[model samples]
Target: MISINNLSYYIGDRPLYDDASLFIGPKDRIGLIGLNGTGKSTLLKMITGEDQPTAGEINMSNDTTIGFLNQDLLSYLTDDSILHVAMQAFAETMKIQKQIDEVLHEMETNYRDELVDKLAKLQERFETNDGYTMQAKAEEILEGIGFSTQDLQRPLKEFSGGWRMRVMLAKLLLEKPSLLMLDEPTNHLDLPSIQWLENYLQSYDGACIIVSHDRRFLNASINKIVEVSAYQLNMYAGNYDFYLEEKELRNEIQQNAFENQQQKIRQAERFVERFKAKASKAKQAQSRAKMLDKMERIEAVADEAAAVDFKFKFKVKSGRHVVKMENISKSYGDLNILSHANAHIERGDKIAFIGANGKGKSTALRIVAETESFQGTLQKGHNVTTAFYAQHQLEALNIQNEILEELKQAGSGKTDQELRGVLGCFLFTDDEVFKKIKVLSGGEKSRVALAKTLITESNFLMLDEPTNHLDMMSVSILVQALQQFEGTFLLVSHDRDFISKVANKIWWIEDHEIKEYPGTYEEWEWWYNREQEKKKSSPQPQNSEKKEKAKVAVEKPRHDDTQKQLEKEIAQLEGKIEALESEVTKLETELSKPEVFGDAAKMEKTTNRYQSKKAELETLNATWEQLVEKIG
Candidate 1:
């Protein structure tokens, strides 16, 4: 177990964490979450000893080993072979191997008993460390992280930034630390690589703490949620879904408690005011005033992020057949990426392009977007206006322009106020709209690009990993927007949840072939998992008297009870939201009072409560809508 005792970190006037304490167990699968600047990374750094806390300490077992996968892997990377970098994890074993090499060289020069004995000792150590098997392990991890055999031999410098991040991940996974901390580990992974990682981490015995914006990744891998905000750490004993539910419950309870306390405070103040002026009740009023002054007030809750309300409106209509391709083939030199791949996209078709890395998912998307030339009978319907959003679209934004200016340049044709409102819909408000794009974070830039896309009315959207760099809240909003998009879209994303919500068809790529699965992403996933189960458990059990065997490999049907439960929860959420709306109004009214201005601390608490309540309401509304959507 790792114990954090009253841990605190302060940078100048900013208190990232204050008096935070928690215990992490050996088998804990924790998802660390919060707003962008709420010290999630800082806390990880403190835990890993990369940075020191301003006060208190972290205590752990002496045998504990930590491995942290940073978001910026390129900073620490070298121009080494991918396989070589992975093998660096076995530092001790490599040292022993070097010693053995030196001893062997000495023996070749002078055959001495001492040299022979030294070599024998080194060899024994190497065998003890399982040095002989490390090469295979390195290669295995590299392959799991999406490096092809040929690619593993290539120098890290030859890969792009995303691929380099994968190489770094391979190194960290190979380390096999007792405690693993990953910051956005899936940010650069393909769908297959992500599934591979999910399988690996599901069976990982070490304590894992990850900070990622991927909601599906959190739900699949984490069993605990650690929320860092308002200079405090809050622990939730569940996954991301549970965390969302539990957080709302917590805020609701907190709001109730605050309301009760405020009620009592108001009563006491009234009593003090009415009696303090009368001589007969002056002594009692004094006692009441003192009691009121000494009361411990409940601090207001802090929101995770401001709400972003936006959606994409498909401005133009397209013909029935949106895109058609026949005998489509793409290759680089002698390497065939797409061998006569055939596919058809109809209007309103939501397609998810899934495949192993470098297996032509993006290539196919590029082909459809007409950004890459390929030998094929490709055709587009008449008046099939298109908009393409690349995975790295945010990187292509003009950083010199301000957020609002970018919107204007996109020809949104909205007034200044209208543009500000639209920007607010993506969590950009106030002075934030005037901020230069160069200074924005990756998430912010992605939101800007999305906002730009929203202003464009295109019937066909070729979006490649549109959710990249977005926070869970932003992702939820984007998913909602895409769900409402009345246009055909082809998406390339490793985010299973997002894909499941947005895509209605699956175009799987493998060996340069396009296998179209006719159904929603959820159906295709079920079919795929069922087949995988069958493949893993091939042989059927023998039956007596030639009895028929059960079809255990089939996907289990979702129980109707789950749907009923969701409905029940949805109804309950409506009630909670209504109650919360009332509470928010009360808080807002209190904050509006002129007397509140005199008490800066009270004003701050009230503002925080309002923000948190508002955020909770938005989340509840979103969840309720999603449940309703599933119901239909």
Candidate 2:
């Protein structure tokens, strides 16, 4: 058990906590939730000894090991494949394996009794550590967190910023610390990855604390909720939904008690005032006054922060057909992400683009917004004012500007008063509104992007993963505002809760086509569940040889004279790939050295080469596979 006894922390003049206490037991899956800048990360850091508490101590068992993922450090520096990092989680075990190898080598020549006894002890330790299955465990976890077999081999630098974080998360999970802490773990994950993480944490034997705005994830994974607000920490015994219920009840009790106390204080004051002036009751009045001074004050209800009411009314209502795409095809070189995808989005349609990450949910939105050029007849209806918020829109913000300045560019027509009002609604208070945009946290940045979307006042809002970093309250505010929004929106989100609330229509993007389904998220999910059940009940042949033959028949490739030439070239390419892979591995080892971090230019060059080689290797592998298929 981890006991946080009267913990207190301060940030400059601001006190984050006066005296906060929490008891974290094994199997305590706690959701650490709060608004932006409420010391959620700081609290975790204090517990992990990454940051010291201003006062009080965190008591824990001596044997406890902590595993933590820092939200601020999303970018990872490594030349090796993601698998290498995941494998590092078993660093102690890997070191043991190395020791075992050295022992075996020594045993080959030295037959001394002492050496044999040493080998036996080492062998026992190896089995105890489960060293044999470490590789399999690491691989299984990496796959579960969305790493493809090919992706596992690709250099860490080859992946985008989001994927790098996924690699980090995979490593942490593999570590299986006694206390697992993650801050906004679902921020960069897609739907399937988030689902996998929830399942992983649900079965996790150790105490887990996750700071996330992903409500569905919290509700599903956690059995407890701890709300940090107003320099106070409140614990609830159930999930997020239960927390809400308990919070409301607690608020009512506090409010009523506060009112009653106020009335008592008022009566006491009146009695003191009336008697203190009189000659006979002067001592009694003084006694009452002293009693009042020593009295404990009852706290009022938890003041809910002013929510951002995003009421974006379009300047002009678009035509009936807001967007029309006829056989729209998007390709990155030879990789056809979307091919002949046709869709017609009607005005006021709140559509959700749902699919796996690579299925082009964002691509379809970009096509609708006409931000990307595609090979198709993509038409916009009359007077369509479009605003697009990409997945990396927060990254594109001009960080030099203050929050107010940034919002000024967004809601150009609004007066300063109205602008401040909007900022306040989004939970940006007096000094916070003047804060530099660059200094904002992930959740804060997402809020700014959402604010910008509202400020643009476009009839067509195409938001790609808008809720990626938003907290529960922020999402609720956005959802409420969007519910009242007069404009049409196409949202690409993995959040089932967010989609279910705002999306009036569903655009299930699968393979290379858009399947427009007219239904709420609940209805679609019901149908999907039934479909899955149907597949489970369906019969299948047990003949292994027959199954293999059928699979080969379905995937067999044609061959000709061109295939013969390609096969010869394929052999040459394979040799080049092997050589390149060896060179890359050597470079990766060199890059991991501590001195490389000191040299910015050298790091940049190595990183560039690392990414480039990965890309080239990927291209070669794809070409080689094509050749092999043709030859077969």
Candidate 3:
């Protein structure tokens, strides 16, 4: 649909892209992967023509349509309600509809021939475009991105920046152009909403180029990976996992080739050195020298590894019960945030606290961290040490201190060398570490907060939106470090992909109630779907004697043949239910155990099977109930 030819772009003195060319075809779903400040978003802007490249051109067919969702541009349109803003994607259809209405009115009043002709043409256009279904399409796109039906009517100005971006996403999806470009589309979405988006994008027919740090989303949604590295663009014809393996293989091959070339050059040089004055072999040595001179030297690509090695050194172990809360009720006037909530975190539990925005996730984190209080029994486990990193922890940095000093004060017990290494891992290397905290950008400050958090030797870590300002590479590094850490983690994150990778248990807070599901995020989703299906299929309880109305009247009871038959059927169903239940239980038990849940594929398969069995058991139980009632 679009072709980028010899595209080179720069920012000031930095070259973002060099001779980068890519072709986006129909049905091509691509994940644009890169490190922080590698110009992923800038490249998208150039592709969409919102930003011009420093050199080269982007060619597109005249009829091709493109929709680009820019995070920064969402604040421009604030007067309209969220629904009205999103519905603007159908403005052309709406205009055509209005024109058709005017023509019909004119024809009805005066029976003008021209009006009738125009009306017929307009009707044809509307039908051809499926203009009648525009509103439904818009609603579907909006709802899929987690916008509540009621939220559509609210003014866009009332919503926070995150929600405004969702409104933008809805509009972009509703437009359904030939090419769809999304930058961090899942940034504000909850787990359910992210899943919904994944399913939607998986089935999206048009071409899409998404710049997102959500690894699981990329692995599940994209068919290709486009990596921007070292002022060049590299294409891998598969998803993120495929890209990883392919990139590694390619690097290994290149390394081996480079090694072989270097060895050949060395041998040739040695021959030339040893036979410089030899009479018989002089010509051969000279030939070898010439060959060595002409040979093109191959250099191995630089090894890219996360600079920081995060190793948690705990000074004190947490008590058996890490944290305890009871009868917790928090409210803002009449709006109850949480009520009668009780929770306990053990010594070695990795808990993911999740919910939609403003559902008391942060509030709960604050309460547990003792930064805030509610009317409840909140107890810290004996010898419990806590290091809490709030979403806005970066704002608390000392402006006077440089990045290095700020990290030093965090007192992670690391030597100067180790502290510098940690700072380098966060991209604050060399003179960057000497920059004052106040001079740093928001993302840099966030990195500083992360570094400072790592310095604390607390057994229990409570991190709120730690990945918010991080780039894809930084986020991956953090995820890896957290996965390897031995300390307990209670994280509040909207990043579904991150949660899926790190969290063993999900504590879902919804509608002032919290439910704990012992599995990965995908498993939680499967279980939720099965529960919804059960609700939809379950029958309402019947009143007493309801079964008697359907029973056939019998003389002398006939040795209770109907009852015996029903009993036999019930027994058979019970047996099936027992077997299914056992399978589900076994899977759940395995998933609940920490060791088994670490294997991503195994965990997913086990969880999927568990969900299927649970659904089957529900069906069998319903059938058994029906049979028992019929027999009665």
Candidate 4:
């Protein structure tokens, strides 16, 4: 749907992209990736016409529409309900409905056939656009992206920036533009919302280009990978994992070619120098030199991955118990977070706190760190020293200090040489260490803060979302560092891959209590999914009698006659359930057809049939389960 040809963008004298080209098809799902400072976000802006490229052009079909979700949308504020804001995607449908309302009002006063006919036309147009279902569609998208039903009616201006960003995301998804572009979309989303978005994008009808640092999100959602590096756009046909393998193979082949070309050039130069001095074969030497000059050159591959060789050591080892919390109760206004919650961390434990937003993950972290006020008893282990790192901590770094100076101020008592080595592990090379903190980008500042946190002598660490603004390589380095660290740590992160790699225990908040699963994230995921399936299979009881009946059905054995009857009933229920499911599917297809929706009578009849069939299917499935239980 969109084509970028020979695109070149420059920031002053530095060329971020040169001779870059990419074609976005109608069904493309692209993951744009590169190291920080490689101009990923800038490319999105250029595509959306927010910024013009220094050269070349971007072209799209005349009818194509664009939807861009960027960080700037976080600042959007409005007093309208979130549902209303999302429903604004159907601007034409809403306008048509308004006109229909006006025509009906006029008919009530004038009692004219002309007004009735105009109203008929307007209502037809509204039905043709499926205006009646727009509100439900908006609500579904808002809830899918993590808004509560109650929050849907709340003013958009009342929410925080992150929440506001989710509202904007819902609006964009509802709009369903031809080309969708997102920049670091997962930054504001929790794990559940991220998974929800992944599922949505998997079935998204339009073309999408996503720039995100979360490796697992990219691998799950995107089919193609585009790397912005070395002043060019390099395309990979498959996902991020495939891109890694393919890029490695390509780099190896390129490296070999470059080496062979260098060898030939060296031989030619040596021949020219030796033979040209004697003038015996100077013509041949000159010809060889000219041929060498005209030959196409192969560029050597750049090593982008950083080696994380820095080791973390504590000044003093803590006791077996790193921290102990008991009877923890926290509240903000009338909103209760944790009540009488208990949790403990051991000296060697690595824990990950994860869940949807507004689940008190960050509150629990703050409580553990003892930085927030709570009605709780928290005890630190003997000789334990703690260091807490958060996004807000990024602001705590002295802007006047250079990167090396900041590390020295961390009080690790390390020399400048040792600190420089530590900075190199975080990808700060040569004179980059001399750059002031104020001039650094968000990612660069994050790396500097993380380096300081690692070099500290604390025996325990509390890192909240440390992987934000980090590239895949940087995240890998941080993972390696955490793996080798000797201290205990508890982290709150939405990155599932990061959690799975670093965490030996899983922590989550449920029913205003801290819940722990003493296993790896992968194990916890399996167990959690099984529990959810069990819940889905077992419906909640309306009263004690129904609950008791269900229990009796499961516990009691049946006589031969009763067993046969139960089996017969179960078979009948299953047949009915299958028929109802098929009916529901057919009704849904009918509802989606233009001929049905464009007429009010047909649309209402199809929708009512769809709902009735769905309800019938649910009851039949329930009956079949009860019959099977009785027989078993």
Candidate 5:
């Protein structure tokens, strides 16, 4: 629906995109990806006509409607409820409805031809667009994004900045434009809200382009990745994971080709140098020299993986217990953020804290880190040390100083050389380290903050939105480092795949409640789905059928004999399965302990027996659940 030809844009002397041509077709779901300052958002602005390209032309179909959600702007209005602002997208339809009402009133008063004709046209248009269901559809979109029905009646000014953004998102979805553009849509969403958005985008018929740092969200919502690098746009098919693999494979191929060409050039130059002054071999020398001149030098492709390397080294050992929170309750005036929350953290535990934007995830983290005061018993284990990286902590940096100076200040005991080396790992190379921190972009500041955090010797790390501005490669490096680290972590992140890969347990906060689920994200999702289906299919009493049977002359059996027998069998099987699973968990935990590996033969025998039993129990449980679901 939109096309760009030979597009080129620049900020001052720095070129953002040059000779970049792209075509966005109908139903295209694209994930825009690039390094920091690579113009991903700038490109979006150009596409939406908010900014014009330095050169080249953009052609969009005249009939197509495009809706863009501005990441930096929030709707401001007086005396307008959140629902009223969101419903403004359908203002034309509402106007038509009002006109129809007036026409109907006029028709009742007088049999006028003009009013009758106008009413017919208005009714036809309304029915064509399914206007009668507009309010219901709008409500569904709002609720899916986590806005309560009661909150809809509250004024827009009552909602916070994040909630207002959700209101804008709901309005965009309700409009159902031909093309949709979203920048970091998951930034303000909780796990459930993100899941709802995934489902909505997956089923949406129009084209969409989203720029998000969340790998899991991109994988779930987008089918194609459009990467902006080296002042050009590169397209890749499939999701973010596929893009990563494909980009690496392509880089390897390019590196090999460049190496081969360089080898040939070196050989030619060697021959030329060897025979330069020989009279007999003068012609051969000159011929080789000319060949070298004609040879097309292959410029070495950039090492895509060298952007950043996060390697955390811990010098302090954590105690057996990392932290403990008892009866923690936080409130602001009349609103309670958290209520009677209790949690315990242990060494080497990678726990993810998940919740909505205002659901006290960050507040809990602050209380644990001792950065904020709370009314509760917050205990830190002996020998426990923490490195806290808050989202807005970078603002505390002295922007007037150079990046290297900022790092040196934050690094404490680290020497200048040590700090420079750390900065290099985060992509500050050569004289780039001397650049002023004030001139750095958002992503650069984030990287600098992270680099400083790495220099610390804390045994426990509290990272909030650490991957917010990081590219895919940077995120991978951080994830790898975290996976290899021995320290405990309490992370608040919206990246589902990152959490799935790193976290062993989830500390989910919802509805003023905190619960821990021991599993990967995929397993948690499976369990949640099972619970939802159970709730939806809970058995209801058949009162009408029971009444009819009560009036019968002959009395039937109290219950179905076959059903009772099946229920007894299923219960026994389930009990056995539950015991087997508990045993399996215990065995797995034991196997993971260092002491158990001292006896290799015994460990192997125990694992083998456990696996056999686990497989049998899994099959039996599956069969039992299938039978139960069928009968229930």
Candidate 6:
């Protein structure tokens, strides 16, 4: 639907993108990925017209619409209910409904034929726009994105920034634009909400461009991967995992070609050097030099992945019981976060706290860190020094200090060289270590904070949403660091891939109590899905005698006259169904024709007819089944 041709954007002397061309199809699900500072989000802004490209052009059809969900929406707040905000997506439908209402009111006074016709037209238009079901649609999307039914009517300003982002997401999804653009959407979402978004995008009709660091989310939701590298947009025909494998193969092939080209260039240069001085081979040497000058050199492959040689180090080994809590009861006036919850963390135990938003995952993490007060019997094991890392910690960093200086204050007692090595693992190297924290972006600040957190010689770590604002490579590095650490840690994060790799236990809050699944995230996911399936498959309990009475009350008696009438009705419905089925088949055939399908009006008309006939056929079939059951 949209085409970006030779797109280029520059900041001062730095070119973020140069001659980056990409085509977004009508139904493409594109995952835009790259390392930090790669201009993925900038591309989205350029498409949305929020940012002007330095060169090249972006073109889209006149009818194309866009819905963008970005971090900026987190600050959007108003007194309107979330449901009202979401329903705002159907502005045209709402306007039409208002016109219909006005027309009906005028008809009540005048009672004229013209008014009746106007009302009929308005109603037809409203139905075509699905105006009657707009509220339901908004509610479903809002709930699916983690808003509870009770919270739907709450003012948007009452929710936190993250929850507010969810409301914006719901509104955008409800808008159903022709091209949907989301930048790091999963960063604010919880696990269940992320899964819901994944399923929704799988069935989404429009084209989508999602820029995210969540690998699992990308793999589940997108069919194509576009990598922004070396100021160019490289298209991959498959998902993130496929891109990895394909890129590796392409890199290998390119490396081999580059090596061969280098070898040939060396041989030509050597031949020229040796034969240029000789009379017999002078012309040949000149020809070989021209060939060497004209040959296009192949660029070497640039590997995106980074290897981290540094691991988290702690001075003390904690006791077997790292942390223990009993009968924890905490509440905020009307909101009960935890009540009589009991859980414990053992030495070397890696736990992931996961659930939907508005749950007490962060609260539980704070309780573990002893930063939040509660009525509970909590105990910290011997030598269990604690270090807590959170998004807010990014603000705690001294803006005047350089990146290396920030690490020095962490007090791990590591040398400057050791700290530099740690910073390198986090993607900072050479002169980057001397860059002041004030010049760093949010993602860079997050890396710095994370580095500081890890360098602390604490046996117990409490990390809340550590993966937020981190790129996939950084997440992988943190995963590796955590895996190699000897400390006991409890973390709250929505990144499933990160959790699956680092966590050995799963924790969630249920009924205002802490719940534990003593297995990896993958295992807990399987068990949880099975449990949900069982709940869906298991029928509601009913007293057999009462159920039979209720059935008899609703069912018609199979009298002789009724049976004859039902059989006759069934036969008539069968004939109608057969005739309608033939009509539907003919419509389908016409719809497939080039003349019919090529014209928009004709295609829409034919599709409407086909759907109308199909619905009629289904109704007849259902009636036929009911009649047959009555006769039996």
* lDDT values, one for every candidate: 0.81, 0.81, 0.80, 0.87, 0.80, 0.87
Best by TM-score: 4
Models, CA RMSD each: 20.6, 11.5, 9.7, 6.3, 13.4, 8.3
541-586 in candidate 6: lDDT tens per residue? 4223323433443355655776666656655665676578668868
Model 3 misplaced regions, further than 4 Å? 98-124, 276-290, 307-310, 332-335, 398-401, 411-414, 435-443, 519-530, 540-632
Better of 2 and 4 by lDDT: 4
Q: By TM-score, how accurate is candidate 6? A: 0.85
lDDT of 3 by residue, 457-572 (tens): 88899998888767777887788768877879899987877888899989977667667898888898799889977964564233123233334321125466666677667667
Q: Candidate 5 — which pairs collide?
A: none
Cα lDDT tens digits, model 1, 240-348, are: 9999999999998988899899999999899999999899999999999999888988866656554445455554689999999999999999889989888999998
Predicted candidate 4 versus true structure: per-residue lDDT over 359-421, tens digit per residue? 899999998998899997999999999899999989999999999999999999998988999
Q: Of models 2 and 3, which has the larger lDDT?
A: 2
Model 5 vs truth, CA RMSD: 13.4
Residue pairs with clashing backbones, model 2: 308-425
lDDT of 6 at 626: 68
RMSD of 4: 6.3
Clashing pairs in 1: none
Model 3 steric clash pairs: 412-455
